[model samples]
Target chain A: MTEPVTTGTEVPHGGTADKVFPPLDPSTVSPQLVWLAITFVALYFLLKKIAIPRIGGVIEERQNRIQRDIDAAERLKDEIDGAMRTYEKSLADARGNATAIARTTQEKLSAEVDRERAEVEAATAKKLADAEARIAETKRKALSSVGDIASEIAGPVVKQLTGKDVSADEVKRALTAGAGE
Target chain B: MPDPIHQFEVKRLFPLEIFGVDATFTNSALFMVAGVLLSFGLLMYASRGRSLVPSRMQSVAESVYEFVAGMVRDSMGEQGMKFFPLIFTFFMFILTLNMLGMIPGFFTVTSQIWVTAALAILVFLTVIVVGFAKNGLGFLKLFVPDGVPIYVLPLVSLIEVISFFSRPLSHSLRLFANMLAGHITLKVFAGFIIMLLGAGGAASAIAPLPLLAVLGITALEFLVAFLQAYVFTMLTCMYLNDALHPGH
Candidate 1:
């Protein structure tokens, strides 16, 4: 308002009555109103039916698409986690089964070895008893041979000592007594 | 030398008269139509693909949509989304008119107070009708601010009434006066450059100074153009909010 007052006085024709108040022109007002109504109404429809909706649809579509993609990604991540858990569980189960099988096999093998060793020890004890009996028989046979030799020597000595020949039974009895002593 | 105000003079392109009313298709009318057509074309082309991953044009279109949509949602809440079309139309129409006028010879339809006033009237009517329809007589309470003493009620209500009725006038004049003043100032400075150069000698040397000033003012006018359009639409939302919730 102050602008027109200042400029109006400074330049007479520059800020004339028409210039100071352009909208007050009766001819200008009606046509402007009429055209503004018509054009604005037309623009409103264009915006409502075509322009705004188109732009709004694209924006909404982009937002929905992003939301859906994020949701899908989240769901897939959960699935992967579940699968990993299952895989780990199965892996642990397999490891346990392998350990159990190994332990059982070792126990069975050790038991079989202990049984085989017991059988071998029994066979060796029987063989040692048989060998001791054989040695005793051989010692008795050598003692009898010594008695025969002692009887022969005593008979020869008696003959040499002038006329006193001892009987074989008496010499065996003497040798046996000497061997016992 | 073209008169600074002569740019605002309306010339009949098609001398039309309807029922004894001079409804001539003047330069202003032409620009008004041009503004609508330009908005329609740009928006149509921008949203042509409608791809999820938007193209550059689609991005530009969506940016405007989001800007206005957010403004409406913020000012009037979700209920205000229903009026998005009207708000967006005002923004695009006025913005296109303001920008088109920056193109040297083009006329700015928004510079006309009649045009701006008509739009403000539409917004005013919408606020009134919607306000009454939604809240009935309770809408009248908007003028009666709460917590005021009974002694001050009459005086306060009178001031409120005057302010309320002046909404359309202020709304329309804010946009119209800014565009008119900026354009006139630019033209005046531009006219000075021509006048100075025509005088020759030392006067011509000073022509570059005004020429520089015009350049700077032209840049500021562009900024004002966008700002004014944004301000107009923003105020429309605030007024519409008053209709939606008339308590305060």
Candidate 2:
């Protein structure tokens, strides 16, 4: 094989180069670090000051709204309890008033009935007294008439039976005395 | 003519040296550029039309977005949304590098420790800075556990601090080691095929088997590449989680 050689250039033929692997040097730092730092700082600040805060604010506002809703519910519950208490008290008051009115009405009706009964009884008693008085007077008149007739009959009998005839007035007086006895 | 490790050598396309630094454009540099350009071009093309019902390209783009988005959300919560751009760029960049290496002549940037270390450091510094900014001196409380007994404070804090500092080291090492091991294994198997075929005669017949193994390992390497990238991002999330809520 004819090998072609270049002037003044020593190319190693058929072997690996002296440098097997690249040198591992710590000094060689990527310049991208500068830009990376800048971007990182800027983004961190932006998020901390603006983006994160906004998200946090939204979360806080939601929490606050929930708390407010809960508080409102508690207040409403209290109001309902108050209203219930008022309703219960009013019911008691209404019941008491109804009972009082019922009692007063019963008493008024009973008193009115008692007065009417007494008036009826008094009127009946007066009528009965007047009738009794009339009967007594009629009885007295009949007895007096019977006594006069008896006296007339007794005067005839006495004249026949006795030697001397008795007077009509004296015979009427004796018959009246016997009838009264 | 064929050596196992020979393929990894960096060759300068344009020979230029500046102050002892080989700033000459190389194959590795070329592939890196290609990876960047390819990634940008594909993403741009995919995202060109904003559609309610996604086109094929848009769907691909959206899928990539959603995959990364879900990872971030799962790992970091809503706070991770802020880091979307960084994590997205990191994932795409590493993914492109890994996929690009599967091409015949392309280089894998993530295989290099320097590159991975740089990325690890970036995440490390970001976590530290963010922790400090958010919590101030309270960031130091991360080293002190809440329920530790008063008598064990010294011992516990020492252990905690050491563990805390090991984050970047482990993060960088895990990616580098995985990539290095996979590439080396692939090269070894590939070298077996070459060595066998070069032996000629009946030995050439056996080359297909090693080649098949290399292919299988390459596929597994591809899975490892994605896993490493995922692990790196997940670790970053965990670190950030610590930064966000220290001592937890």
Candidate 3:
């Protein structure tokens, strides 16, 4: 199996060195080729069956993790949007309720004021009518009393002055004329 | 009488020789050690700070890493990340060895059949082990083409097996042959320039033509060094892809 190495040159006087470093025999193949084949086959199996799959699994897992993170971000965004919408709606509802309450209170206060005014007007009108009636009655009483007292004093004077006249009616007429003068 | 082959003989530097084994350090061993040390030291220094914002050295390191990384990803897909370490190591080692050879007095390890063969064998073995572990007995299906008639299975399987077995041989030979042919051609052309100059007078003026050719070949060899390393790593990814998916 030990072949003479080619020196890239031709020489004349080939001696014992030619025999020692013989040209490689083409007919006789080297066994190293067989060993190389065996080694190659064994290595291929080990890598394909074990190492590649493990590495591939790691790659796939990394991709899956990235995808999951993206999905989680999307979910969080949706939740935040929903919460914002709910908050806005509640705030609007609260404002609407407050406005309604304000309007109702305004109306109630106006109605209450109107009712109180009407009641006060009614009481004042009734008290004014009673005062007017009392004044009219007192005036009538004062006018009748003055006429009766004047007539009584005037009848006594006429009776004494008109004795020869004979009748009470004639005496009353003369007393009225004296009193008027 | 000078032996032409003796020009290629390697000499040891150290005086320590054990049992005529010539264990003393040689030019090839020196370059190999230099390549390994240079690669390790450069990478360590480049990645020392490991900053988020890269320095100049870190940028260079990152570019190399990303280049090889992109190659693996493009050839083998996302699943290729697992093989990053092995693929990166192979690319760096071959690249270092190839580039180191450009320096004067340094030997190119890839020019040797044993070195390239060893690398190829490692890749071949890795693919096989990976394929079997992945598919179990079903890994044998790689040797049997799907959709073939049962009558033709034996022929197809045999061809497939032969082709599969030929990978290491082709892989090794490709690197070894390119490096060997390139260096030899350079040497031969350089020898011409020397021979012409030694003739003296007007003949020395014609030496520039061969000298120019040597320069051109040297540039081409540099390109080849990088190309060969790239091709080797690319093929490794392809084999890894096969192991991952046997029939496909």
Candidate 4:
């Protein structure tokens, strides 16, 4: 702390030897402190007023922008998801309608085939009955003719055997009585 | 070899006498202003773009700001944001000074005890003023520890008081001593290389040893420079934390 406050930095006036240790020197301390306070105070105000706020503002602005961008991206993603869901729902609905249409057409076609089959079977049955009736009439007619022919042949044979002619009415009555028995 | 202490000598660049006081603008003052101005200009210039995506220089500037900003926030919390400007000033100013001193032949302002002592005293005074202003009489409760036995409480309190008062001493000396010793070691190692090289054949061959030591110690000094700045700022934060919430 020895101080006579010299004009130069070193204690020895003319020597080039830097013998005075400035760190421990008491003489230069006040000026060092004074300039320190001056520059330090100046620096404090410079940073406080201009540098810090500007940098901080930039950082804060970037953060806000990032958050906004993220939010927008999230919203877009949600919209895309909504659109995807709608597309899937409609796709499923179309699939169900196609299946229903195919099933209905199949059922309708099969029902038409069944109705035609049933109608054809009924028509075949009616035709068979009509054919049977006509056949039965022909058979009845032929049997009546056979009876008449039999009556005539019997008369002729009786005439030939007995050498006498017999009436058709009498033969007919005999054949009828035989058939009944 | 020249005086190893020669680098620390303050040469008067511009002499000014104000009312019989020697407030001469020395080399130390020149570096102080240079450090302050360079950091200020760099930060201002880096942030000039204000780009959402920062440039390399901008990122570095922002990182430094955020580093100190984060330090204050962690130690002192959101309420301490009011002191952010002061804290930022203290951090960057001291950081620039320490880093500038790492350059060959540059004057280290922090190597002086008065400057560090003055800064420490400023922080000490800030804590006292802020503590009393924030908590009034409860600021004194900082010395009282929780869960102490009632009988030994007085001894504990006295010890706490002593530690509390010694904060500035330790704070100032920690930075000054670290810088002084680290620089001296580096200078000594450097001196060894010159001495060895000045000697003839075999001794000159081994000069690389001290040169290597100089290199390694220089790298270590860079770490120490940054570390001391960080330590000083961190301690300031802790002390301010006490001021903000003096109960603990």
Candidate 5:
């Protein structure tokens, strides 16, 4: 015990303290084992009954909640997709209806313009015919008047000419001869 | 100046006999009970809240549960879930004991060979029981691995058998030795600092060396404390897997 091993303070005590390594001491073994048995059994029961299940339930419940939340989010996404589809369908239908309405208006306006043009052409032709007929009648009347006027003039000129009371038949015969010449 | 081994000594707390045996409760027993109560109490308190959104402490408790559960699932498959309570108990109890021992005055229960041996033997027994129960006599296939040369199969089987028997020995001793050695090293370094300071002269100037070593070792011991508990439980799972499926 008095041996100078690494100068006293650095000593590794072997013979001192009941001459037994504390970890391998015989007297403490049985007590520790007994208490360990009690401890292990008690801990196992405590964990099995209360601790494990409680913590496990909390964790499991959290996991289930997360899964449910994910499912709900997925469902909402599907609903949004459905709504988008409906919106797109209505948009396409409205576009098609607008095009159809514009096409129908154009066709109706074309038909109306054609009918009005035909009515105008018919009225103009009727007016032209009436004017030509009046011209023809007036020309015939004028020709008859010119013959009377020439007869009157010729009679007056003969009376004033040298008291020559020439007969109308003579005048007429003269005129005819001149014409034939 | 201080006895490093003295920390491992078990003292009589309530000296009483049970059925004519020296079953008087000792300091070692006290720590075991403390470990039990600490583990159980913390888990109990942590899990008390049933909110869908777990509190921080609850989350931690759940992580511990999930950690062991995941380990068991990884090593032993889903069927190993039946042993979850036992495995969880081992990890939490040992971890609690190891951590509590880090406090200056508390006894390190796991430092004792007897305690660690008991734990390892329990796992060993569990493996054997489960192995036989699950595979019947086919559990011996664990030793005789597949694809050994036909002539050396006997030698290989002999080695496997030896390793299989020695598992409990190594398992128990590994934890015990690590804890005992680490704590003793820490105490020894701490003692050196004091011894140098007590020299009261130029040696005191060099006391910072042991102080630094002690600080570093303390950190290492903390890591080792958690690591040992992790390793012990991990092995427990692997052994259980062997029991569940004894094939190579």
Candidate 6:
């Protein structure tokens, strides 16, 4: 704080506040403008010709590539959906066909079993009818024979017990009456 | 030890006079070239291997591209894309110059009002040329507000014209003043550190405080460097927008 702080005035150069402050300085304006123009125009052309286009191109390329990949993914997804639909359709069709085949086979087997059962029943009925006819015929013969025996036995016993011979007409009449009783 | 402003002195690096004009290439010119070369080198190197997946430098390039692109596109619409190169060039130039000034002993090119004003005037001239070329007689409509009464139209038009003409002044002064003031502030604070240290033992202890402030301001100045460039580019876009759509 003791020593005075020197400003731009003592710089020994021409660029002190006295000259530089009036931004409209005649000496510095033209050169600065000239250099600025030269460099700026050069820089502009450099950017236009090289820098911007390359950077912009690469970014645009990347974006386009990403879009293409997304489109491909969407297309593949659609294909998968189509394939799955077809597979499901075929599976349903196959299941229906199998069910139809099973039902027809089941119907045919049931019809065949019914026919066999009917034939077996018819044969058993015929056998039963023959056996019944035979039993009836035997029963008729036995009844007729029992009647005759009864008559003959009755006449002999009567004759033995009474020690008298009975007439055939009387014996027949008595046997008939005893048989009726 | 002499003066902080002494740092702003423009020393001629090469003496060259053309057509009886003192066009000796000065330190300002040197840094101006340096700024251009730095920007070109950075951009060229960054964009050399233009990759889909950007490398670090590639990202830097892409970021700068998108940043300027967005500024031009948002403010001026698709039609404004034509000015991207110019705006980008200006942004890079000013940004590089501002940053160069931050170096220990480099010249702050933007701190020179003439330099900044020249850039502003260039933008101003471009706006005028483009405005008239695009809109013809309609460019004058920029001075006439749509809602103003006929009687007050003259007054409003004068105000508009004044404001329109003031664009270059404001644009150039904004950058120049900011760079100049920031440098001056830094130099003054930096001067404090030396003065405090010069005061010897006890004062030197407090010198670190100003040194700390210098560090903070230096960081702020770095941000200002980028922001000023951005502001200049944004304003250029806005002015260009006025040219393109001169009706309102």
Best by DockQ: 4
Task: Pick out the ten consecutive residues of candidate 6 chain B with the lowest summed lDDT.
Answer: B1-10
Error in Å for residue B11 of model 4: 2.5
Predicted complexes: DockQ each: 0.36, 0.03, 0.02, 0.52, 0.45, 0.38
lDDT for model 1, on a 0 to 1 scale?
Answer: 0.87
lDDT of each candidate versus the true structure: 0.87, 0.71, 0.70, 0.88, 0.87, 0.84
Off by over 4 Å in 2: A1-20, A23-181, B14-24
Per residue, candidate 2 scores C-alpha lDDT tens digits across A42-114 of 4435434543343334445556878999999999999999999999999999999999999999999999999
**Taking the tens digit of each residue's C-alpha lDDT, what string does model 3 give over A1-181?**
1456556323312222232212121111122223223333433444345433433344455568788999999999999999999999999999999999999999999999999999999999999999999999999999767666666665666557874434556545665677679
In the range B1-248, model 6's lDDT, one tens digit per residue, is: 54666666666677676676566687778888888788888887987887778899988888888999999999999989988888888888888899999998888989888888889999999999999999998999999989889999999999999999999999999999899899889999999999999999999899999999999999999999999999999999999999999987
For model 5, state the Cα shift of residue A147 in Å. Answer: 16
lDDT of 5 by residue, A1-181 (tens): 2334333322223233234678887667778899999999999999999888787877777789899999999999999999999999999999999999999999999889988888887887888788888888899889757655666666668878867777777766665576559
C-alpha positional error of residue A60 in candidate 3 after TM-score superposition, expressed in Å = 18
Model 5 alpha-carbon miss at residue A46, Å? 0.5
Clashes of 3: 31
What does candidate 2's lDDT look like per residue over B193-245, in tens digits? 98899999999999999999998998999999888878887788788878887
Error of 3 at A141 (Å): 71
Give a tens-digit lDDT track for model 1, residues B16-122: 76887768788889999999999889989988988888899988988988999999999999999999999999999999999998989888788888888989999
Cα deviation at B52, candidate 5, in Å, is: 1.6
For candidate 1, write residues A1-181 as lDDT tens digits. 2244444433322124354555444457767778888899999999999887778877777789899999999999999999999999999999999999999999999999999998888888888888888888888898777777778898878778868777877777877788779
Model 3: per-residue lDDT, tens digit, B95-170? 8888887765566767766567878988999999998998887788889888999999999999999999999999
* Order of candidate numbers by lDDT, starting with the best: 4, 5, 1, 6, 2, 3
Off by over 4 Å in 5: A1-17, A113-181
Interface RMSD of each: 2.9, 9.5, 10.1, 2.0, 2.3, 2.5
* True contact recovery of candidate 4: 0.78
Report RMSD (Å) for each prediction in the order shown. 5.8, 12.8, 12.0, 4.5, 5.8, 4.8
Count of backbone clashes, every candidate in sequence:
0, 0, 31, 0, 0, 1
